[model samples]
Target: MGASKIGSYPCEEIVVDIVVQKSEKIFGELDVPPSKLYTQFATALALLAEGKSTLKQPLRTKDTLAILRAVENMGATVKRTQEQLSIWGVGRSLRPTGNVIDVKNSATGIAMMTAIAALSPRVSVITGDAQLRARPMPHLLKVLNNMGLKAYSTKPDDSPPLVVLGGDVRGGRISVRGMNPSLIPALLIPCPYAKKKVEFLSCGDSLQLNLALDVMKAANVKVSVGKKLSIPNQPYRPFNLRVPSDLSAAAPFVVAAVLTDSKLKLNGTDLASDRGAVLLNILKKIDVKVEVSNKFVLVRGPQQPRGTKLDLSLTPELLPIVAVLAAMAKGRTTISGASEARTMKSDRISAIAHGLRKMGVKISERKDGLIVEGQAKIKGGEVDGCNDHAVVAALVTAGLFADDKTIVRNRAEALQTSYSRFISAFQELGAHVGYAE
Candidate 1:
């Protein structure tokens, strides 16, 4: 598939190729972002609390920073240092800045911030960059309207530039049957501020659902998540938390170690509660050696990875790199249940498939997933990043295992949207990575 204009976005002019060379050995310890969702949720809750909240070790990527800017725009006092953030929240009395909140490239930022904006009894507009505006918005307008907030999309496709005339909401019953589970926090975060108790008539299961419940727990909000769930009308309490490292951000490095037959360590993550537990199990299933400690995970790559089936219905963000791992494995690998990939900033399934197929891997793209025939080694070639961070990182990782130099062009800027230090980290691990001259 040829890269289209929409695939380039604002990143088209940036035009830098991430150069990677086949590595005989790749090893290092890198600090991954504590969960991006955790950071954004914590910030949103902090904005709703009465007292000051202290968050340690939060991920400071472009996306998370956009959320922080939105929090500040919504009348919260934010103090920052090198390692920690202190936010003095406005409680239920949120003040609007009388300006548009532009979340740039963060889909997560816009969703959480829109809910926060709706808590104020005034008009608020939320917008984003082109790529972010192209991503799908959750079907929450009807639910928000039912709760006394008027929310609508300016675009027919329900893309961003969302307008909300919001205020103190009258909470009512909602159903999560058709809603995207990753966006559940947008609904849950604002429930405590509603005039009445918010009740969820039905709840679907997902890792994000569990993470939302976890975030609610830490913020001292009362939530019960069974077949049906409810959040009582109360105040979100200010919290002190050390955010857990992001497993999705760590995935590329893990796969790099696996593909290179090297040992690597990832710091500041707790597998017992992290969303990466499923990825870890998948790694073991594919015959990778993994050791878990309280604070770090140690991974040893196999000489030849054994291919297996994967279901990424709940964790679509991991699909791109996992697909790369599958391409380098010893046999056929099938990935299913990731229809959500189509709704992201890019159609990640198509993007990754096109990139890998260009590198001489046999891949068939599916509506929701992929079927990849593993090769001992694939040919090095050029691939477009398609203005997606995960796809860029995945292509770079695939480059490490290719037969010669690989060049990933377009949207290298997308890396800053999530993992800001991807190139430096790869270089530190002794992998050959550089900008194309």
Candidate 2:
């Protein structure tokens, strides 16, 4: 895929120049977009199904477009309308184009596409842009090889430009015990197409892991879960469903509202699923006032916001912004079980710590997470986005609460990977945010 193709989406550019200033008052109301995770997972499952699948209100960002193209290259036919996108699946009859599939900066996209490609009895090469190429896929590739694909990384460290010769799943039993939760979906999604019944050992559970199972169940794929997880060889039936609002995308705005003591209402976000549940649980620990209706989430700043401990093992992506929220709280906040974040687009743990320290925050970076002594006020300074979208968003939220101006540097790329309208959304709320190249 070419840069021109990736940049063709209507969303904001991947690289953005962003600046934020402390705001005394800001207010807004907007709907959070669909979940990128759900969009990607459902798209992959649809590709494996036997008939047409309808995905309503699926997100159409540059990152997600990569997944769409990758699936098209793997024998799925897609038709887009104003209201929904229709996909005619290949019915477990995997076809590989053999052309190198480009996933751009989407980690989940590349992981799911690689697994889907392995079902085809042909050669497939998976690669991504510079930022994504730096992240390794050794665990995924190694597990795929064991499941009958000749998977390996082009580089020694097991980074992208991954090459796999698949369609030989000699499936009887395999163990994905202690594997990274993010990569487990890569194994489970393709197991049903194996030559024999597939049984797994040590397939741990997480929000994402359960979410994958949810998507599978929706597609009419049966996987018996017990002391051991097992999937009989079968084909996926087509599914139709609307993707839920993305809680990850709504996090920045939620944090901004909390830090600025402003009222914010987010429509279309559910408080019961995915990262939404995680965010809701985290908010209860703090002193914020949140009202949840059937259709929207309303948040108000607390008179005396305080910090508490958090375990981000299942929701590591929340660590960055949560760290910022911790800084603004009234007590010590300990965040643990997010060591996997070190291998993301950037070392988020290090990036957030360094950026907060620049803003005069009392914080300590630990191997697995961070320990922060919350302060009532902090001086604003320049912080680096480290080319990660979540880090950029987190720093921007931090800037909104800082005592003065905050400039987020190295936000030159990957800002739109998840939340393309982050800056625009804040601006609509009357926040003092702008572009500063």
Candidate 3:
């Protein structure tokens, strides 16, 4: 999946350049876009359901398109509309083309799709973009093999391009670290279709499994969860659902709002949302003023952020923007429990530390997290986006509060992978941002 095929921003150059924000404060109501993360996985799961599943207002982004194509390749009939996309699921009866599926830069799509492909009696090769290919997949591949898929990575380190010979899942169990985002769902989604009942032993905290379960529950698949997971062969029953606004997308604004003398009302985002809830907790712990309800999140900022011991155990995607907030805060901040971020779209912990340091931030990077002594004002300069969406977004958020000109290169294009409306959302909140036209 090339960048151009899905209408992603040009890969070679900075297509849209943003100027460093002058002293500005954003205030207003913003309707954050629906969650592409949930939309992609739910759409994939819908493709495996027994009947028509309607996804109302699903995000129309390059990343979700990657997963949609994966499901399309597996024989799901997709009907598109302005307000909805309906997937006529083939359920366990996938007509595998035995063709190689290109996921471009979405690691989760490939992982979940590979699990679905293993249920078919065909050989499926899953590949992705350079960054996606470089990500760690062997851990998930090893677990897939234990479930009897014969899944293997073409690369030595168990990275993609991954090869899976699909036939039958023997429904065995495997123990693994809890932090691999793609591992649990990749297994849980396919295990039910296995010849026998599947038991998955989570070697660490399996909180992410609850998300997979949430998607499963929405699709009408029952998964027994406790210390270990018990997956029974229950057919996915299709249903209509609307995707909530993405909290990950809303994160930059949250941090931005906190740092500026701004008040932001975020619509379409819910307090009960998994990502939003985590963010809310973190803000409260750090003393940022936030009020959230089931329908909206209201945030007021310039609250003088303070450094507190933080654990990103459940929400590692929070790392980038959290790093920005930490850099702007006024004390020692320790971020831990997110070492798994190393395998994401970028080496996030390093990317955050290095990129912020480029802006004159004092920071120390650990294997799992970061330690930062906050500065009164960030002396902004130039930083690289590392072609990671979160990295670019984080940097952009940082720029909103930086002291001087901060030129972020190559990252403006990364917004296509997650939130293409990032700049617009910021601008809606009265940010002084624009492309280098």
- Cα lDDT of model 3 by residue, 284-401, tens digit: 7877877878887878877888899899988887798898898878798999988878778888999888888888788999888999888646767778888888888888888877
Provide the lDDT at 332 for model 1. 94
Write one digit per residue (lDDT tens) for candidate 2, span 1-437.
11110111236664556788878756767677787778888888989898899998888777888899888988899999866879999977877675689999988888887877777767889899988898877777777777776777889889998887766677877888657887787678888878888888888777777777888888888789887789878778999988877665688878777766577777784645777877888877877668887478887764456878888887888889999888988899999999988877789899999888888888998898999988746677778899888899888888887778888889545667777666766677788888886
Ranking by lDDT: 1, 2, 3
Q: Supply candidate 1's per-residue lDDT for 18.
A: 87
Q: Residue 149 error for model 1, in Å?
A: 2.1
Preferred candidate (TM-score higher): 1 or 3: 1
What's model 3's TM-score? 0.93
- Kindly report which residue pairs in candidate 1 clash with one another: 34-245
What are the per-residue Cα lDDT tens digits for candidate 1 across 1-437? Answer: 12111100111222477888888767766665578888888888899888899998887778888999898988999999867899999987888787599989987778787777778877899999988877656466656666666778998887789998876677888766677777777778888878888888657777877777887788888687677888977788888998886666688888888777577777765754557787877787777777877577877765577888888886888889989989888899999999888778789999999999998889999888999998745778789999898999999988887778998888787888777777776777788898889
Off by over 4 Å in 3: 1-14, 203-207
Question: What are the lDDT figures for the candidates, one per model?
Answer: 0.80, 0.79, 0.78
Per-model TM-score on C-alpha atoms: 0.94, 0.94, 0.93
Model 1 CA deviation exceeding 4 Å by range:
1-15
Task: Give the residue spans of candidate 2 off by over 4 A.
Answer: 1-10
Collision pairs in model 2: none
lDDT of 3 at 183: 56
